[model samples]
Target: MPSFSHDPLSPKDAADVVIVGVAARGLAAAARRAGLRALVLDLFGDDDTRELALAAIPLRRIGAFAIDPADLYEQLAIHAGPDIPVVLGTGFEHQPEVVERLAARFRLVGNGPPTLAWTKEPLMLARLLHNLGIPHPQVFADHAPAGMRTLEKRIGGSGGWHVKPASESRGWGWYLQEELQGRTVSALFLGNGHKARLLAFSEQWCEPSEDAPYRYGGAAGPIRLDPSIEASIASALDAVVNAAGIVGLASADLMLTGDGWSLIEINPRPGASLDVFDHEPLPPLLRLHFEACRGELPDLALLTPEAAGMVRGAGVFYAPFSFEMRLDPLPDWVADRPPQGTRIETGEPICTLFAAGRDVREVRDTLARRRDQLWRDLSMASRKAAE
Candidate 1:
C-alpha cells in the first residue's frame, strides 16, 4: 500500500506548483506544459493521473498527492507549504464553507465571487444573458403549462441529472425548453474585465433519447463556421464578457434554430469538451488562464478553422445487492486503470472513453465503438466472475 503523509511542505521539495485535481485533463495538461513541477492530489488513488504527471514532468521530480477535496488546502499547507501555487479542480459548490475560509491563505487561481455566485442557478444566468440581448434558447425556471415540452435541469449541475418528464414538479429547478432538432453548441471564452475573446466553438448533437433529455450520448468536433455566423457569435461573446466582467473559462451552449440561433445558459467553468482544444492547438486560451492567475490581461485572438469534438463518455455502476451491508472491494475491471486523465469511480462512474476524428460524425462513431467495447469487456469480466 502507498504510504500517505500529511506533511507536504519539505524544503527538499522541487515542485513549483501543486495541481489539486490532476485527474482533470485541462489542469494536468496545463501544469505539465507550463513545465511546473506538479504534485496531483485526489481522493481516489489514480494510477493514470499519476503516470501522466510523471510523463509530463520528470519521473523523479513529479509527485502524487491523494486526499479528499475536503482535506485539500490544509493538507497542502501542512505538507506542501503555504506558498505553493494552487489551482482548484473540484466543483465550486462541493465545499463552499471550506473554500471561503481558505480563500486568503493560498495563491488560488479561479473566477471571482460574483462569477461563482451567478452560476448557482440556470434562470439567473439566463436572465443575465437575456437582459444583455445575447441570443439563447428560451428558458424558464417556472412550471411549464399543460401542453409544452420542456427540459428540466438541475440549476447547479452539469453532466446530466435525474430528468423526470414533468408536467409539474418543484424544488429541483430546471432549464425548461421546447425540444428542437438542431445543434447543441458550446463556445469557450477567456478574458479579463469587460473585454473577452472567443477561443473555440463546438457544435454537438445530444443523442436523441425519449428517456434521457438531460443526458448527451455523444458530441462531435468543433464546427467550422461561415464567417457571418462566427461574427455573430463573437459579437455576442464580447457583449457577455462586457456585461458580466468575467475573465476565466466560460462556455455558451446554443442551438441552430431555423433561421436564427437560440442561446443556452453559460457554464462559468470549463465544460465537458475542454479536451477538444487539445486535439487541435489553441494555446491562447491556455495562456489566458495563466495570465488571469498572474493578474495580467492576455491579448485576444480570433478562432481559426480547426475543428474537434467528443462523444459522450458514459459509466456503469454496480450497486450493492442491498444497502451499505455489502462493503466489498471495488471489482476488478471497474478498478482497472484508465488512460491518463480518464475519470474513474468505484460505485458510480466506473469507466469512460473519449474519441476524436476529422468530423463530428466520425468522432461520434468512434465514441460509440469505444463505449460498446468497454461495456462488452466489463460484462464479460462480470459473467466470468459469476461462473
Candidate 2:
C-alpha cells in the first residue's frame, strides 16, 4: 500500500497526492475540494494553486517556453516520498520518456507512459483513428502535400502555439495536417481502460498573434451539442479509450465542420476546460480521475446534471508589454495570478479570467468584459508606477 502524508512544510515527507503540470491551479483546487492534501509541482505555482495545495514547487523554467525535466525529477523525488500517488497535468504530453521514468519512481495515478506515448504521437494516433473508423484530420508526417492548405504541428506541444503554416519549413519534430475550417470543440471525459463516460463539451477559442495564430485563449461550455453529433463524439471517445487503454481524465479536440467532426488531437490528462465544467454536488474531478485510474468508475447516472444547464468560461489574459505587476486588489474572477512586483514580459500570460452564466454566449461575453477590465486596471497601475 502507498503511504500518504498531509504535511506541506516538510519537503522530505510524503503527500497524499502529488500533482505535476504546467499550470496546477485547476487540479489543485479539485484536490482541495476532495479533502486531499496535494503537493504541486508545476511551471506556474500561481497564487490560487499555492493556497489550494499543501505545498507548491515551481519547476525550473527553460527560457520562456519549457521546463527542465531533470529539475522536475529532482524536486518530485525530494517532495513525493515513497509510493506516493502522482497525477500529471499539462506540460507533460511532449515528455513521454520523462513521464515513463517518473511512473517507475512513483505511483502515477492516471494514464501510463505507454498510453501517453501512443496517443501523443500524431502519426500513431492518426493510424489508430483510421483503424477505428474515427474521422481525423488528414496527416502528412513528412511534408505538406503540394497546394493543399495545411498546418505544421510539433509533437508534444500544447496550448496550440506550436502550430504554424507548413510553408514556413520549421525543422524536425514537425508534421503537416490538412487544415479544416470549423468550430473548435473539446470533449472532457473520464475513462476506465475499456470505456469512457462523457462529462461536458466545450468550445475552444484561440487568440491570434503575429507569432502564434493558434495560441489557446479560452473555452466555453457545456455548449449544447446536437443529439446526433453528441452520440458520434461519445462513440469515438469510447473507441479511443478501448484502443489506447486511456484511464482517468482526458479531453479530445475536434473540428465540427459541414462534413462532420474530425479529431484534431487528444490531451491525455486533466485539461484546461476543468474549471469550466466542474461544479458542486458532484465528486471533485480529481477524485473521479483517481477512481477511474483504479478501474473503479462511479455510477455514471449519479454524476450531476447541472453542468449541462450551466455555462462557464475561462480566458487567459496576456501581458501587452513588459511591465511590473501593480494591480493591488485582484478581482474575484481573476486566477492564475502572478505575485505583485513580478516583472511580466510582453506576450506572457498575466492571469486567467473566469465567468459563469445560464448560457454559453452570456458567459463568453462576461469573460470578454472581465478580460478587458482586467487589462485596463493593470495598464493603469503600470502607468502610475512609472510616474
TM-score of each candidate? Answer: 0.73, 0.94
lDDT of predicted model 2: 0.83
Q: Least accurate stretch of 10 residues (summed lDDT) in model 1?
A: 318-327
The digit string of per-residue lDDT tens for model 1 on 24-132 reads 5455555666665566655433444554453221111122222244456546665455676655654443234444655667666655556655544556667777787
Candidate 2 RMSD to the correct structure: 3.3
How many residue pairs clash in model 1? 14
Best by TM-score: 2
RMSD of 1: 7.1
Candidate 2 residue pairs in backbone clash: none
